[model samples]
Target: MRLWLLLLLLFACPAYASEPAVDTLPPELVRLRDEGRLTVRALWAWKLVPAATATAAMELRAMGLDLIGADRAQLAAWVREAEEGTAAFSPAQREVLSGLLAMMDSGDAAASADMLPADAPAAAALPVPGVVDAVPAAPDTVDTAPPAPDVADAAPPLPDVAEAAPSVPGAASGPAMYRCGAARTGVSDASGPAGPPVELWKLKVGDGPCTPPVVLDGLACFGSVDGHLYAVDVATGALKWKFFAEDWVDQPPAMAGGTVFFGNVVGDRSGDRHFFALDAATGSEKWRFKSLYYGVNSSPAMVDGAICFGAGKHVYSADPQTGDAKWSLETSDTVGTPAVSDGTAFFAHANRLTAVELGADAEKWTFRAGANITTCPAVSDGLVVFGSDDFNIHAVDVQTGVEKWKFGTGLIHHPAAVHDGVVYAVSADNLHALDAATGTEKWKVNMQRAGLKAPVIDGDALILAAGNFLVSLDRASGQERWRFEAGGEITSPALAGGVAYFWSEDGHLYAVR
Candidate 1:
């Protein structure tokens, strides 16, 4: 009885051991494929091998994903099954699987399905997401269907070829040049004598003050450290749209054609900079240029089918159509926007004003100043007027490259604006009007304790923003005409349409008529 019992036990133990240890799959994986919790069709294209295939690796690389250990033969066999119209996958899924397989064979691992020929059937398929192996179904549970034809067996269509280039419109004749950073192309049409100020309308923008606004096709555009460039309706002061940047925008925007351009500082060293062009009507991004130097502080200028701006120590001229750089002029230090006149470009670098011939790629001349130039040069009436930190206003003959004259103001800031024949500028405590022809001081007004910014001229009034005051003065004399006070610092220059537009440092943009 004991021997029989031992034999029975030994046999039972052997039977138990041979029974394939009750194979069990993980709940997560089972849920992934079986219940549509995840789909097996998506995993068909993943290459199983790391080496043995360059195309597979590149595909993974372009998607910013990593592939570790994988089996090449297993991956290929799986792809072949998918391409042959395996019923386990939908037609759309099989197409994606085939593309992934072809990418692997081509050694273009990063190649995207979008790069496939438009006529390729796989191009119409939706791709699977994520990375992992599909759980194989039981043999009895596998779907039965007719196998698909291999794509490699079919000849691809010939590539479409083109020879004649498309015609483009010829460039329009260049607009007349005005030197003084003044937007005025010629004398104004208004001929009325000075009288009582006319009120148009007043609309408040925000609390933080902003730079003078640029007007384009009835849209007034300006930027603030508040990180927005606003376009307001020129007639109604109604909000059009606001474009946001990564950081503060201290400079006014430049508007040309139908685009608006501006820049901002970014990154740890503030060395990361970006320039953006937005649609003038919709405020959508048209294009952008980024750099590793601190953001551009100078406003951009457009001329001769190019957009030019200063970035770090280089001056860039980019194609207006595609934002492609045409050429760059490298410099040793920071520079300002180049003023274009008659195919010549003038810009201030450190303490020197340099002239560059636009198409010739040569320096025409450079005039030395005692201090750095922080303001844009105004060109008009055959003379160039600008301010320098050296505490003097220098007037140079544009044609002869000679210093017409220099007047010391004792306080250095930016240069003056020239209109008619007078140069208007401001020092720390005084505003001076000088004769542009000879640089002779015409009249001086003591501000006592006021802090003034660059001035703008509208008709017969000089618009100036100082501290909390936006003051208008008679152009012929230095007498204050009208003043409006708001409770904030005035850091930007004033702009005038029919009404005066200015911003307060307290974050408010104001329009006074």
Candidate 2:
């Protein structure tokens, strides 16, 4: 045979005896190889070992993905990142490793091997502040001192350590949870400061938007888009401690019994499923709960000794300490953040609003709306109030699931705040105060916009966090009392001791008296 014919003849020698036929190979892998998903070098090496029988299933146990659907995705990600390692593998992991070793030891010049799951989140907390008596200088411990202002004349000096204030006063004895109290009512019993309030202090957290501040134990706590949950000194605007979550932290941290509960909402499936519990004072993790599908967008609502939240397609109640599931109610569609009132969790799933018992895991009732529900169900009195995509605010009887009233609005995006028999709903550019029982419009005021966030009832004023500005309207009459414009995108105010703490996208946490 000629040189080319001799090589072609050698390549054509297929089945020796014990090896599986080429037709018996996995069609999916063959399809992937044919589509050029695998690299040229990998395909060449795979061809070198014609009898290699390694699979990708047992090798990716650490990735925490749906293994049945993740072989291609995980392998692609690993190869794209140029994965390399010689670390010890678990027994099952070694099963594939042994296969690769046997091929490599067969004197083959190149043998292809899939990568392991190295991107999974470690069980231990990464890095945080105040976990011990002394923490060496690290990313979590930051010294945030502002520079002098730029001005033509003599500028005001920034907050100096020499003139530093005393310790941040503790927020009474009550540990603050998300959405005002455990009920998630968005109603604060205490009043914000009267008149044009003065700026007390501002501290830049991370280079991203922050979750609404949750005040507890002398620390003003919040999560940042920069993947950290920060606890700052309320009095001095100094960084106390921060917990690095390694993922976007959008939801507010709920605190109780010296533990902070928050969620990590990762858009990518790589790290999308953990509800974390960190120590309130130390920033150390207590426990983390996992879920399927998308990361946790719903904030945890602590109620009746169990932490309740709707994650993915299930309504889950976990123990506050161990992160163990107390009860889980599987739903047909996605679920929203739940508000607990009288042992019942009210959440919106697609076009229906459902109520499930927190303790018994029994579903009380489900109320179907005309359109997709856009907001969390706010429970007040005996009614559950929510907004639908059809531009109507529906108030359903909490016990019977019967629709009490359906009031039309221009464009209702956020849930209505119910306080003192009043349902405060915000439309595109209008704020309406209606009777909670009758759904009768009592007052309506037009503004530039109602803002993206839900309305917060602070004493007699209705705070419309109009994106970057704070509009305080008289809750009774819908008259504007004060409108404070922030430097960047601001969130709804979290009131602590007559002070309003606004988390701004400008990376500053503003404390206004």
| Number of clashes found in candidate 1 | 24
Question: lDDT of candidate 2?
Answer: 0.63
**Model 1 lDDT per residue over 63-127, tens place:** 11112122334345656754663322323333544554443344332354363433222312323
How good is model 2 by TM-score? 0.67
> Which lDDT tens digits does candidate 2 get at residues 1-513?
598976776678744323652332223334444464422223212232222111122112112222223333443443343234322222344444343333322322222223222221221223322333221222222234333322321223433323333344423365576667756677986567677777777765564456678886667888865567777777666666666676656667787777778887542113456889876655667788886765566777876778887767888889987999988988877677788888888887778888877766567898887766767778889988888766789999989989999899855656678899998888777777889989999987777653546678887887757867877788778887887777876777877777788887665788887
RMSD of each: 23.0, 14.9
Per-candidate TM-scores read: 0.60, 0.67
* Local distance difference test, each candidate: 0.55, 0.63
Where does the lowest 10-residue lDDT sum fall in candidate 1?
A: 138-147
Among these predicted structures, which one has the highest lDDT? 2
Q: For model 1, what is the C-alpha lDDT against the true structure? A: 0.55
